[model samples]
Target: MGHVMQVYLGDKAQLEGVIGSKDEALLSRLLDAAATEDAVDPKIFRAIIDGGPFDEDDADEYTAAMYSICSILGGQSIDSVVFHFRSCPDIADIFYDWAFEDLLPPPEGSGCAIWTKENNAEELAERTADTGTDVNDGGEGDEVDDEIHWMNESLLAGKDLIFFWGV
Candidate 1:
């Protein structure tokens, strides 16, 4: 596959299986157009009103994250989650453990993808090129990792969560 994205609306039960996806009809419809035009559908307002599958509420922040993800696909930005681990091995370790090794018990209702099972080789290679990292690896990954960590953390903590990912 050239490039693909698989978004999740809930937690990985054991680094593999996930709960059902509730908002694909909403997110997929929005991103399908946003991918090309770098614009967001008005439906985003509704998604914001409904609150996140997680707890992130500010539509502007989520919008920035969403468009930033689009920027990565267009080569205008480095992949956020990918560069996070490449630069800050320590912080990356915390996130990575949650991603794979299960360092923290995943939040109960958090929407997250099981990268090992879901990511194709092309995406994996891109994520862990292991060559070099952005000058501000810690800073760069902070946004992406924070989005993911707390979403999962909320689930583990039994709080509202959201669906978030990028290719």
Candidate 2:
């Protein structure tokens, strides 16, 4: 299976905040598209979402739709390509936490870690691994703390489309 990246918009606060009318509308569209039986490209899908305003409900929808898409594509055995806006550090943390906790597996060579400007790859990797969670990038480039090395390799291979907005 080809590598797939799951991009989520909005921060922790925005995700938990009240839903907005515009965001609700966009999310409805995303859900509709994500539920389709046809193959979905992360690039095209993210473009559609990025074309409009996203809110907390949008975040939830993105998360749910991502899981659904993964299941449709096959299962968690495949690696995920993730991108998110880094508007708030807390939000970034929340996104990472959610990604690590819910979406991505515990490194285990099944997951990848793509950080935004707000994320400290080293620190996040260490903390994530310390929590008894397997993570890739734990110490240095060659360490291979966990199975997450695939993610680092992806980054080195020039997967630039995936990013965490540092704004």
- Which number leads on lDDT? 2
User: Which sections of candidate 2 miss by over 4 Å?
Assistant: 1-55, 64-143, 160-167
Whole-structure CA lDDT of model 2: 0.36
* Candidate 1: 10-residue stretch with minimal lDDT: 13-22
Instruction: Tell me the tens digit of each residue's lDDT in model 2 across 1-167.
Output: 23234432223222222223234454555557656745343433453235323333334334443444333333323233343334333323433433424322223212222333234345546655675444443564445432234334333343211222211
C-alpha RMSD (angstroms) for model 2:
13.1
Model 1 lDDT, residue 94, Cα: 34
lDDT by residue for model 1 (35-79), tens: 776655544523432433433343333433343333333312212
Cα lDDT of all candidates, in order? 0.35, 0.36
**Candidate 1 C-alpha error for residue 160, in Å:** 9.7
RMSD of each: 15.2, 13.1
Error of 1 at 161 (Å): 11
